[model samples]
Target chain A: MDCSFENEIHLEQLMPLIEEYLAQGKPVKFSPRGISMLPMLRQGVDSVILESYKGVPRKYDIPLYRRDDGCFVLHRVVKVGKTYTCIGDNQFNLEHGIRHDQIIAIVTGFYRGTKYYSVNNMGYLLYSRIWHCSRGIRHFCGRCLAGIRRRLR
Target chain B: MKIKDGYIVREVAGTTVVLPTGDDLDLTKMIKLNDTGKFLWQELQQDTDEDRLVAALLREYSVDEATARAGVQRFVNKLKDNGLLI
Candidate 1:
């Protein structure tokens, strides 16, 4: 007989704190959305635990958003400025600039598929790089697909 | 917005982008876009109507009046046909 250990993170277990950091800019949860965080996080599936992002976030780092519509958006931080600017990795340009105080957390980890990984560690930067460098082209393709998706139905 | 010159567009991370061509979307089977197609997509996001969109494309891409008008019409028709337009 053998015994093994594995770590599991659950969404119900994660939501309260995520709500906290996110709304108050205190302890936050940076849930994954869309394909921008791809190769790192999955769309509509992956999620992360975030703390109050205190320092400046670097280019290619993912940031949690409280959008103008009061909806939260999670996208990549593409430029470091007095007001941080983020865009989806496959986007044409930075969608909006947020005050530093508005950011909930810089994504420190990712959950791809069923496995959990640390963005602070190795093997993750490569994924981030591909998303950043290829953003423009990726957005182009995605927009094309959006058109196609509409047509197919 | 029209795509900048010398680069094609692609989608990554759910956002439309303009990069070198040839990168195919490999994640989901749906929601993919090419460069010129992305330029058209951006225009839809803006407040401009179809005629303004055609004019803008002509200025940016520097195509002849007929070509730009035709491209914009095709893209807008596709958008309407697909129910993306109101």
Candidate 2:
């Protein structure tokens, strides 16, 4: 997903509405939670923009899943197979495969503050490749940032 | 709580199912289950206690105690591995 649809929100304010949107079939939203999609999504800053699933996702499309435990995540599909295999752009390890039925939304666009971008466009291609190449370093940085967030929280 | 509580689980056509109620879930993290797993899931909703659940499945499926216990244990292990249970 590219950064395009930005909705300003405080963490406290965003949470309730995100919850409500999920329950109401309203436009889905959430603050990016990790650097998994780093350089594309920023933790605690970039806001996610989701379109309800309209069909099976194609390669490179970002999709969201509602895990049995109820946490939601956004990741890009690396492979479309008997099960969809998704991976974070800036991270190692493929996430567990999810059936097409498990997908809740397709990330049609993204917003980093006020800037918007499209996933299908060239601007996103450059960013995604950079993210893929620097994944090792970015993942290390991401883990450190995660630890800091945990302690601060 | 109601069986579904604040959430709704409804099957939609073409694998693009919907979970229209509750929190915005990160669907990417879910561990996809096969038919056996789905059957075991419904059974969990009916009863989660380990022993009682095993007993019920034993009766319902007309399986021997050993076979039922093994099946229950394997399924429960998978659930735990996926972080679906405490």
Candidate 3:
């Protein structure tokens, strides 16, 4: 079966298999194709390991959820009470009132090449915290001065 | 050589995708095994050699010795390059 080729598969067709793997308590690994969680996750570079989400996702946890119209998304939770308020790291708008049932899996860790970083890693925690905390200013500046400086430097 | 542990063969949208459970290997590589690759992967699940692989392929497909040997060699080299074989 060594005749391997690259092919693009729709997420809708792939999500069920991922969910099945997660439900078996197995962490599914794949390279997510999107720019929503950009900087942290690239379109075709970084790979993420996901496990089935158990309960309410806490603040800052990245969960793969489906929108009512059948759109799938991966975003960070900002507010969690009866419902969740999530926004992508690369986007400004807050998506409100997402119920727990809507969430499929939570990112446990990720990799850049062979380097793996856990969600609980101090550096990752700091990065996510700073990114989310500075979202307000970043959104206001429409691309903050600090971010530009960091990129430039 | 044998196929490394933690790799699984799954079909998605008519493509046979390879996913790894082991994190130690490079996670950035997305592997899609073609039909021949899939068959040899099954053969490599256990300890095997080049001759054995070529023989297996010959038995399975209506191909000549040179073709089967070349296919096995190429696939083996690819697996080795990707660290999919131990």
Candidate 4:
């Protein structure tokens, strides 16, 4: 496998240090490296401040969790209880039964350019609720866009 | 100039970064360190000047004096801009 990717570390390798900040009750900020949290978060361009997850995650909270296969995911919570159900905004499927232990952090704020927007920010709250509610329309629009691109090719 | 306290060089899965802890985390950008940047960050942890950093780079890597100086200058300027220097 090609390993030319530089300046990027696996989430597992970085978690201990992040946990130290969390344990101190300090928020940790880092750039997420994927498109799974697009629109609100842009890979490399946007960074997020993650707080340590306490108790069960509430609906619409974005969480950073690690899977059994050691892959790390930052997705939005859509359900709660014995286990959580999460789905990325760009994704249509729901990931169910994600235990509390799997969740390491919860995103409280995000930085777009130099500006920081807290989850409690009115715009952010409205965006999350509206986005979650409009998944069907967004998904359909995405399919239409893909089909257009295919036809263009 | 000296590196500020609460800012540390951390390596994870081969990625090196200058991370700020405690009240030092006012910055919005995450600073990723390359190999040379990592070396300089470790050196700057103790108070040192630009020339000393260049000399250290010359000793550590096979780079020549001018290149080392430029590298040191670039790294120091970046830290300075980020308000990471004390």
Candidate 5:
């Protein structure tokens, strides 16, 4: 079946619908747009499976959270405290003071092309750890790569 | 007729998206409805019949009775074909 739509829904509106589905104890799957969670997730390419989070998010776990500005961000937890500090995988800055109630769901898995990678998968786990550790180096490499791609263009 | 259970309508961008919830997630079908289709779908949700739906379309939109009837028939048929009608 053809299962696609060309609608650009706001995060505020979509969150309620996603929460409703998760409230029913069902995983919600949808393609997220943005370059924030780069490398791991691609805009218009990857689809994520989200389940309602139960406890505090650990370091390196990606959670879908809402900011005070009513914007939803799917970013990795960098620090866990009374309030979690998060940073997008592709971002250089850290977003601090995210509350527990602000977290809507945790990404359990994601589909890249036809292959599905679970958060529990050993390869994904290893990659997550390595990616988190090497952010500085990756950031530099990403800039270099972008320059090269621009030159090619 | 009513829209079947497990289906939720959302407005995305400027388009209407009908998403199936719960176990119906596997359906993976994101149905996009036009303005008229969205109006009709909302009417269907409130214990509406084909006649009432046509009346609503005629009342809300600047369409003639014949056009409204034909539009309602086409819309209902499309919903039936997609197994969205109950």
Candidate 6:
């Protein structure tokens, strides 16, 4: 049945429910509303499957971590050491000093339309590596593309 | 027929919603059910057919057999269309 919500539910309010399900070993799937993980994940279009992370997040792994401001960010781990540094695929700024406790879950896979792409897929791994390596250039090109789109509008 | 696995029924913001989880995560569409629909869905969790559903509706509501049958048919059709029934 075509169900529409008259009011939007905030992510903070939904996190507890999501956690409860995950605690029961159930994977939570929902359409993430953001433009941060662009190219790989489209806003309001792609849906992701989030499962409770078992171990420490490694570099190139996209983990959903809660920030000190209480906002959950699904970003790629760029560096792993005493602290994890995460940066969105579509952004230039890197988020540093994230601890393991702040991380909620890691993305197992995601659905693009009806097709499912696992995080461990060879092509996805290659793309993530390349994307992570060329963040500066991608950021510049993304800005240029956005400017062009705005001008066109 | 039975309601498939990997679907969770939750009450979100005063709305009863059926969301696909696990392997069915690709299903982006959320199904919202009313009080009656929710009850019927719970019943359908076990093995049930249209006649049994219609009978349950008759037992619960004061509707006639024909009306109950039609309602059950419509509900079953909606679930089938959404690939919710197995």
| Predictions in order: lDDT | 0.57, 0.61, 0.82, 0.79, 0.80, 0.80
Cα lDDT tens digits, model 1, A110-142, are 556556777776667787776678877877898
- Model 4: DockQ vs. true structure: 0.21
Model 1: per-residue lDDT, tens digit, B1-86?
33323343343344443322223211211223445566666765656676887776776675777777777777766555544455
How do the residues A79-113 of candidate 5 rate in per-residue lDDT, one tens digit apiece? 99999999987788889999999999998998986
Lowest lDDT 10-mer window, candidate 1 chain A? A1-10
Interface RMSD, all candidates in order, equals 20.3, 14.5, 5.0, 6.7, 7.3, 6.4
lDDT of 2 by residue, A1-153 (tens): 010111232333333434445556655555667687876788766766676677688877888776666666678887788888788876688876678777876787777876777676788877766665676886798799999999999
DockQ for every model, please. Answer: 0.01, 0.03, 0.29, 0.21, 0.17, 0.16
lDDT of 6 by residue, A29-116 (tens): 7777789888888977788889889988889998888999998899999999999999988788989999999999889998887789
> Which residue pairs clash in candidate 5?
A8-B13
Compare the candidates by DockQ and give the number of the best one. 3
lDDT of 5 by residue, B1-86 (tens): 88888888876556578877647253235677777888888888877898998888878888788878878888887788878889
Kindly give the stretch of ten consecutive residues in candidate 2 chain A with the minimal lDDT sum.
A1-10
Off by over 4 Å in 2: A1-26, A129-153, B1-86
Flag the better candidate by lDDT, 2 or 5.
5
Candidate order by lDDT, decreasing, is 3, 6, 5, 4, 2, 1
CA error at residue A85 for candidate 1, angstroms: 1.6
Number of clashes in every candidate structure?
Answer: 34, 16, 12, 0, 1, 0
Q: Per-residue lDDT tens digits of candidate 3, residues B1-86?
A: 89999877878677677776553222245576778888988999999999999999989998999988888988888888778899
- Model 2 residue B8 CA deviation (Å) reads 24
Identify the runs in model 5 with alpha carbons over 4 angstroms from their true place. A1-6, A141-153, B1-16, B21-28, B32-34, B39-60, B63-86
Clashes of 1: 34
True contacts kept of each: 0.00, 0.04, 0.36, 0.11, 0.14, 0.08
Candidate 4 lDDT, tens digit per residue, A1-153?
Answer: 010113455567677667777887877787888788778889878988888888778999999999888888999998888999998887888899899899888998999877989999999999998998999898899899999999999
Comparing chain B with the reference, what is the TM-score for each candidate?
A: 0.61, 0.59, 0.90, 0.86, 0.89, 0.88
Q: Show pairs that collide, candidate 4.
A: none
Q: Give lDDT tens digits, candidate 2, residues B1-86.
A: 00222323333221212232535543323233344444555666553676876676766666777777777777776556645554
